[model samples]
Target chain A: NSKVIQTPRYLVKGQGQKAKMRCIPEKGHPVVFWYQQNKNNEFKFLINFQNQEVLQQIDMTEKRFSAECPSNSPCSLEIQSSEAGDSALYLCASSLSRHAETLYFGSGTRLTVL
Target chain B: GDSVTQTEGLVTLTEGLPVMLNCTYQSTYSPFLFWYVQHLNEAPKLLLKSFTDNKRPEHQGFHATLHKSSSSFHLQKSSAQLSDSALYYCALRYTGANTGKLTFGHGTILRVHP
Candidate 1:
């Protein structure tokens, strides 16, 4: 069974609605990362968190998108206002170390914006 | 910004044929390279990674050699199987960073026909 777990395998939200996805990292893994995979299979890095602390993120993660990895809780990525461009597969990954040499990923949450 | 380049969009082959996927990157600092495979309806999984120059990294039936001079880590396999058909992504991360986030390339779809 996959160690990394993501809830709500699929989500459908209309434009301007809120969309939230949650993830649980692998046991003992401290670094968690979120990536967006588009229909063309292009992967985009969204955010990284090191045990509840923001490590690095891209421009798309700001203002509209909010992500948090709280201690003893599942990490979540939320979109305040969904757009058609935001419809994609959201993947969560965790690494044994902060170096990101090897990562374990979840099945991902497929989000669709209409 | 660090970036990975993969020219191939799709590759079609028959079973037992050899497979080679091109991967190259540009980075300002020492970089770590990786290959990820995503099966149908499955999450992207790490297949291999390389940090040491000229050293090859192999997982399952796939292998890649890191060539620093050419900045390439092309994946290769002796023979392809129908099960091997999947989407492959090449990624890179800075080896000397506190925030080691991956920059991914446009994925290549490998279709192995029986």
Candidate 2:
């Protein structure tokens, strides 16, 4: 089975707290992507990484969120100051390449800010 | 700017009925369309994808045809099973970029009743 592993399936944080989620892509995948799904089930693209380099990122993701895919480590998305609006499901996906490829997604980390 | 549009938010059908989920896209580049299916509490998996060869892609009884003229790649099934009840997303890949990011539509939830 093609599976992506995400840590902390559910997370709860205070308004000013920090939240971090990690994803281990499938065995041989080379690209990783982060997306946020809101309560309305609308998915917003956050950022993507090829190896350890940031390929593309949305404005909102660059401002409040930071992601890193260190060598041999799982990819991580961290929020410095979590807000109520940041409460959503954060999904991590991976693909073999950047073009004309299929993505395999993780179960996702559901974040709730109090 | 690139975006995908899924017309049906929810579709309820009896078992063994044909299913069609509408998908439309707007992009400046030669878009590569895809269909992903998400089961309950699971990650989204690739169902089918469209290339530039004007060939329709099909998998596990689901099919999608890309129409460059209409900018649509609607997902259809001859007969949907109860296991087919899930959320479906239509996605597009950016042409010029080397990033593996995908712009996705809102989503359509299919509920197959017995």
Candidate 3:
């Protein structure tokens, strides 16, 4: 029922391995966001973008995470080195505008780090 | 800093019972509140959103009113259904901010048993 599409519904990786996930935001949506949901179900904001420009990102994301929403390309979030702590669901959401009240989310990529 | 608080981590109810999920928030600027529901292995979809004109938003038998004076937006349903079991999150983003960064609550898990 959601237009936002996320790829690789599941990912398995070893520690220090790179884990990359992609998301295609809903059609005509320009604002994209990435959030990490842990086993405890705590939602941690990772990064967000307005069109092709980065808007805001947490410090942890600035260090070990690489995310971008490029024109004509699906938005992606890649972990440089996966850790056990990084084993969680990575959710991508998009909205029609930067101030839009409603957000559409993807099924999310569940990463399992060994 | 903006934060959303969901008082209950889990709520168990029998089918046909009324459902209520409490949510509160603290924000620096004027914000819009929202409720999102995620079924098992599914993407989170917008259940309801607060209106600026004191309008109560509702979808799929669920409703929530934005009480700006109390800084609260609680989800409520007249009766619970078996299909209503899911994770519910309360989120908010400041209207004045150019960035659409949503501060989400830890989420409340609803279990409806027949």
DockQ pick, better of 1 and 2: 1
The sequence of per-residue lDDT tens digits that candidate 2 reaches over residues B12-108 is: 9999999999999998888789999988888888899997788888899999889888999999999989999999999999655567679999999
Candidate 3, residues B1-114: lDDT per residue as tens digits? 789999999999999999999999998888989898999989988889888899888899999988888989999999999999999999998777678888999999999999
- Which prediction has more favorable TM-score, 1 or 3? 3
DockQ of each: 0.74, 0.73, 0.81
If you assessed candidate 2 against the hidden native complex, which CAPRI class would it receive?
medium
Q: Tell me the whole-model lDDT of each prediction, alpha carbons only.
A: 0.91, 0.91, 0.93
Better of 1 and 2 by TM-score: 1
- Tens-digit per-residue lDDT, A1-114, candidate 2: 548999999999999899999999988887999999899888998999999999999998888899999989999999999999999999999988898688889999999999
Which pairs of residues clash in candidate 2, taking residues 3 or more apart in a chain or in different chains? none
Clashes of each: 0, 0, 0
Best by DockQ: 3
* Alpha-carbon shift of residue B91 in model 2 (angstroms): 0.4
Lowest summed lDDT window (length 10), candidate 1 chain A: A95-104
The residue-level lDDT of candidate 1 at A43 comes to 90
